[model samples]
Target chain A: METSAAGLEKAIKAIKIGLSLPEQDHLHRELEELLGWLEPLLAFNTGETEPLLFGHEAVNVLREDHPQEGRLAELQEAAPNFAGGFYLVPKIMD
Target chain B: MELRKTTVRQAADAVWKGEITAHQLIEKTLKNCSVLNEGLNIFTYLAGIDAVEQAKAVDQKIKNGEKPPLAGIPVAVKDDLCYGVLPTGLGSPAFSEFISPVTAAAVERLMEAGAVVIGKTNLDDMGQGSTTLSSPNGPTVNPWLAGRTAGSAGAAAVATGVCMLAVESDSGGALRQGASHCGVAGLRPTTGRVSRHGLNAHCSSFARVGITAFSGEDISEVLDLISGFDERDAATAVCREGISEIIKAPGSKDITIGYPVTAFDYLEPELREIFEQARERFAEGGYRIEEVDLGLLREGLLAYYVIAMAEAFSNHARFDGIRFGKTAEADSLEEMYEQSRAEILGREARRRSIFGAFLLSKDNYGRYYRQALKIWEMVRQEFETVFERCDLLMLPAARSLPRSLEGESGFLEGWSEDLYCAPVSLSGMPALTIPAGQVDQLPVGMQLVGPPFSEKMLLAVGSASGSTGK
Candidate 1:
């Protein structure tokens, strides 16, 4: 499938990214070339093969669920805006 | 001090025996790092006084009769790996001042083993590209040849002796290719062998914390210290079987190294010649070499990028400026996210994020994402079948020598450089790249890939046949 400007716009919206016209044009050409390069993947017959997610097949070890002290204060130090143990964000419902 | 000639074992031994104090070694290393950084741009951040203080503590520990395995050894950390004391830039300007609250498990283990961090090395934007040119801090110059890219700053640091070992991340062969470009040794351990708790996620399935050093011995030593099961990272559950037993170096005579003759066809003439010379060296050293067919090179490359991009999109979604990263001034939350991401991410990262969204879209999900996953399985199976006959697979580290810094290669052009390395990554096995030979005064590396949990065998073979290039 060819990557159209409309499709690119929809993708940009889906990812919540804002790009200028020039950036979009550059990305369009590059993404089209990359997608074209990936075309051979479609030719391979991968039938009967299971999709490998993680490289190793280790069963997840369950841990006892319990409340513990978190690094909220130290984490808040790296935040752009934090007050009263909460991260401050722009109003969404106003 | 001629730092280039020093090895991690020599430095650690000297410090342990009190032949040289940790402070003295650290001072020399800091001086070398400063002198080299100006010309080579090897470091994104240098520890300076902090490194000296850490070394002093190691010296005091030595006086107290405690012999740490990596006593007073200097290490260069790739910027992508979180080092709580320094900024974890991830190769973006927006993160130039962002400090991680927690240190990565790998780095913490290194420190506990007596490794002092010299500084954070440069990397590609968001660690997405093989070439280190996309970093906001400027390109890391090659130390071996003028006007050539280093491909990775960590490799250059090890090559220049600024650090004894460099802890770096490899998703699609950045560490291995960079080692090839800089004439050093790099080991990308089997996925989940090392904990990924503090690494800023790229491709969760393929990205692994790896080691780059002057010799396979150093890589092996550091690998043993860092590889273990971490409760914080569930992926590391694979290491519960004990890493020490799996890391014993075996004799070369006991190993059968396999080479894919068709894979060398993708390499340039000079690089192909270098690879042949490496195979001859191994054969001369009494190791058996055989021909193998890995027919899915091209398909593996495609599937790697598709899967990597899709996963990177999901991984980077959390960088929306509310809880982490620098926020952009906007009236609405959506605009804040869009503007912050646009300002924070570099061109290559943005391109990948957009492409990732497209690949994972409902219309293309099965056509691209799911198909790539299935191909990944096929690549893994091919390796499994090959390893049943051979103990290791030998391949070229990069398709060509380091590219010229004078010209910029396109995104697709950059992807071509990873042709040989990415397929091995899909196999989810450990691969070690060591300096095999040189062509036109530039170094070329050959990769020794092995089955999962076979790092010891790979490093032993690499050390036996590897060269430390001048």
Candidate 2:
């Protein structure tokens, strides 16, 4: 697929990340080259083949509903902002 | 006390027989690690008194008449695997101070079996590239040769004798390629064989907790200790019991080994010669070798990157800097998210994430992502057909020798390095990489791949082939 700087920027925006102008340009060029390498993937006829999402086939094992002790204090210590037993985030509204 | 020449079996036996206490062994290992770390840069964090205390516990267990299989063996963990006690840097500056609340299940099992964790080793930025140069802790120098990349820090730690085994993760070919470069044995176990609990996910489907050791016997022993079902990781439901019995069943000369002739075309001349010698050794060892075709090897490489990157993009969504990692200061919520990820993630991490977003976008999802998945199915089917005729497949672990530290490799060039190992990964099979021989004084490795849950058979064959040890 063809890629452009604007299209690439839009994709990056969806992921909630920002890059400098030069970095964006470099990413676009690299993506274009990488996509070219993937061109051979289109040569095969996969109309009848189903997509394999995982490497192995396994049924998900479920556990009984139960509450367990949580490591809230230790988890909070690694966070950048936390207070009053809650994670702190920048305010979205005034 | 020469760690380089010591095997895990010998060390554990010595400890069990009272020849050496676990505490004394750990003390000697710590001293060796300190001296080696200054020059090799293999460890990012070295355990201190805590390691000694753990070893003492093992000694107490022996006093009580309990014999642990991995007694007094020192192991190193890749930084990406969470250990709770040591800060898991994930090869990024943003996470240099972040610590996991829980340890990885694989590492926990090793400790339970009497293996002491020496430290956390370095890696590529979030395990993106094969070369460990992108780590914030600086690159791990190759132990075999100076001014060369170790490919992965876990391999270097094992090769340098800082640790007897290394718990590492491999999404594509990082573990195998690193072992090839450092001249050691690395095993990427069958998907779902080992638990992924507490591991920082990069590519959920392909990413697996693997092991690197000095010999195939060590790898087999450790695999038995760690491979089993864990309710925490649903994927491990596929793992069955009796793995110990299977791995210890003894190597059989009646098994058939499949050889992919066309795949050798990708190897450099000198490396190809080494692989040929390994093939001859296998044949001389009494195993029947048969030629097989793997037409989708190159196509599998393409599909691997597409699926791996897309999964990585989804997994990395958790690293928003709010729950973990250092958050960048910004005026608004949107800017906070943007600035934090932009500043925290390295170039390769960001580049792959952005490309992943593009491939999975609505416009390109069917054109690229869906097509790659279909090709992935074909690749798996191809391997399944080949395995029907042969019990094992032998291939080169790497296409070329480790590149020099002074040279800068382009992104494509780096990706091409995975040409040989990625296809086996895409098949979701178990592969064991052992030191075949050396070229120009640099070690080369050959991998033996088997069907899913065939790790035991692979290790048995690998040990018997006489390709292990530098």
lDDT winner: 1
What are the TM-scores, per candidate, against the unseen true structure?
A: 0.97, 0.96
For residues B1-470, write the lDDT of model 2, one tens digit per residue: 66678778888999999999999999998999999899889988988888998899999999999999999899899999999889898988898888788899999999999999889999888888788877777788899898988998899989888789999999889999999899889999888889999888788888889999987888978987898999889888876443332232334566888999998998878888887887788788777889999888888888889888888788788778897667888899999999888867788788778888888887778878999899889999999999899888998888789878887778888888888888888898889998889998889988888887788788888777745554
Superposition error at B38 for model 1 (Å): 0.8
User: What is the DockQ of the complex in model 1?
Assistant: 0.72
Give lDDT tens digits, candidate 1, residues B1-470: 35567667777888888888889999999998999899999898999988999899888888898999999999999999999999999998889999999999999999988999999999999999888878888889999997999999999999888788899999999999999999999999987889988998688888889999998977877887899999888878878876543443345566788989998898778778888887887788888888999898889988999998988888888778877778899888889999998887788788888889988887789989999999999999999999998888998889888988887778888888888889998998999999988988888888989988888888887887788643
Separate DockQ for every predicted complex? 0.72, 0.72
Q: What share of the true interface contacts does each candidate keep?
A: 0.83, 0.82
Report how far off residue B216 is in candidate 2 (Å): 0.4
Task: Note the Cα lDDT for every prediction shown.
Answer: 0.87, 0.85
